[model samples]
Target: MTNYKRKKLDAFLSLSFCRLLSVIYIVHLPHLDATIEVTLRSMVASTFSMEYPKANRSFTSMSHLRRQLLPKTKDMPSGTGFGLMRLFTRKSPRSHSSKKKLPAGEQESESTTSTMSSTETTSIHRYDSGRRYNARQDIPYLLPNDEEENDRAHQQHWMINVAFGSNFDAPVQDALEKGIEVLDSGCGPATWTLEMAEKYPNSTFNGTDISPRFPQTIKPPNCHFFIHNIVDPAPFPDSTFMFIHQRLLSLGILENEWDKALADLMRTLKPGGWIELLEISYAQYENAGPKVTLLMQSVVTYGKSKGLNPGAAHVLDDMLTQAGAVNISSRRVAIPLNHGGKLGDLFWDDFKDIFMALYPVVGRLHSDLADIEEYKRFLDACKTECSEHQTALYWYRSCGQKPSNDE
Candidate 1:
């Protein structure tokens, strides 16, 4: 095993360290067979691709790769993870590169792993044990691929459904019933997609997320799930979807990236297709307790410090309009904390969903939060405050439509 010090970690936080650390963590955590070294090399090389012979315009540049790899570094924009390299490392004329030699024993192990991986089933490691993701492209998503996240997504769908009084608040609900193509961006656990698929058998549903948290088996015939990053151009060609629904992107998107993401979605959407973005804001509500306010402040501050936009939901409508969508509209669903109503109960659970994921993200970025026990008391205190004081938070739901030729 490699002995990594804080210096190693610091450089790793700046370099393509998380990608390497992912392999290390996976190797040590699991009873990895010969396949470990092969998978490790592939993932590592994929992430740290300095072998580009020409300038690849797909990404900003090679150094952009390094910035993309680490989100929890001190060198990044304070509290947020939006810092990519301004200076790019241009590729040299030569395609062939110098390969670093490994130890004799390590080389033998890697060689053996490669051979075994080819002959046997191509098994990929799943991060079901915790909230850690292995792939570099999956950095935007913060939630773990565990059953807890699966259940949390499930519960969240139920809460959203009950809160909105419908599965979706889009105007095309009628079109959905009549049968049309629908896309669920960032469809975590596939709960919303699955339920909607079952409900509207006529409508075809496609869901995409970086995390393979959704079950591949036991899905409806009309539904399909793909591992996709919403920030990139969607695999689906232009005018493929009649309706596109994205939920909870505010939690993951940086302040500056939503425009590109919105443009990508607009391109994939058909003329007159409806697009909806739903998010729960971390900003201050109409009423908030001291503990709750403190928690929100820390979350918002830490996120901005890293360059993420915790308040993205608050500005989603503007983004949709900026994307050149027509008929843009929004609704803010006020959720009172434990206000002796069923809705309050649902909002309370939603708060659980927020803080449950929030703790790990902040902990990963800041050392002081490594032990989340402190957050537990804070959550408990906030719960009591909600129950007693009727403090509230809001869910922002916005929908728009692509311009039709006639319009």
Candidate 2:
């Protein structure tokens, strides 16, 4: 098998094992923070089979990863993942051409260093078991072609189609036609960016992330990767890109930085180009049901304890509008965190739903957390609320265009 394939297999195996350990740890550790760390170490160990010379390296590194976990705060600013799905999902964006090739060895070293700086560990080897693990862990989740699940997810994606239809497709398609430059910030494993590059061979697709886990490839002369933190100044200059895409970046970015990031991204956009914002609000509460609302609050409080505030979703639309994008609007979608009449069932089901959905793509890109079952009790309560028809999840999707000022 190719080295890449082998690494993928190793990652799959390691993640599966750590998932099992997480199931066990959840029973012992009541604290979400502690359990998340333990789960991360187990998975990392599975990747790095050989014992490191440093006895506590895994533990220390896991802590470092935790610090970077940036809690999803209220009104957390949007990131690249949210940007693409909102702005560029319907079609490929325009891109510039480049034939530059960083040597294979040099590229691998850069990726390793990048991962270490974020997690504070110098242990991952490129093309070794750990790197392969990264590849494997990302592929299945983002591109799961299971016709049934894709249908379900596509259905969810489509619910917003009517509300944001033209805004979503036109810019990406326009960019592809014009060879405009595109940026995918916080791109996890290049799922969206790489797919776009393959579809639009004439355009350049730039993917930036703190981890160097992207595939080192001989680009088709139109794609590249960079290590950048989106909250900071981007690498490119003003009006350099035709489009910028950011999604789910709530953790690392603060509220004040939203305008700055907006200005920075606008500087890169060509006249009349597009920018998209993808976010999920955390501010859900029941209207009248007493018991159900309390249970909802408890479940939501747990998320808040982990630094996730559902309220951020509500604020992003206004922020994007204030930044001066035209035709700005947002759609709210609900993912049933609980469907049945049991709290354990509700929380556990949604927890597993999110894990099963995202783990294949990016779970391993970050640290591992609690077991699928740990949230069962919570899910059951949520289900009861849902059965009473008192449960709701408010997720926000918003996008806008840079005015064609030159026109």
Q: Each candidate: RMSD to true structure? A: 19.1, 17.3
Worst 10 contiguous positions by lDDT, candidate 1: 113-122
For this target, which candidate reaches the highest TM-score against the unseen true structure?
1
Return the number of clashes found in candidate 1.
9
Model 2 residue 170 lDDT?
Answer: 33
Q: At residue 235, what lDDT does model 1 achieve?
A: 89
lDDT of 1 at 319: 88
| Per-residue lDDT over 1-407 for candidate 1, one digit per residue giving the tens place of the 0 to 100 score | 33324433444443455466543733363365545534543454344322121111112223334345434456544533322221112111211111223323332122112210111111222221123332354355445554445545555666677678776667887898999999999887776777677678899999998767665744566788899877778889999999999888765676777899889999989999999999877885857877777667767887787667878888888889899998988888877777857567656765765665566554544555455565566678789987777788888999999999798
- CA displacement after TM-score superposition, residue 78 of candidate 2 (Å): 47
Error of 1 at 397 (Å): 0.7
Candidate 2 wrong stretches, greater than 4 Å: 1-170, 217-221, 285-310, 338-376, 380-392
lDDT of 1 at 394: 82
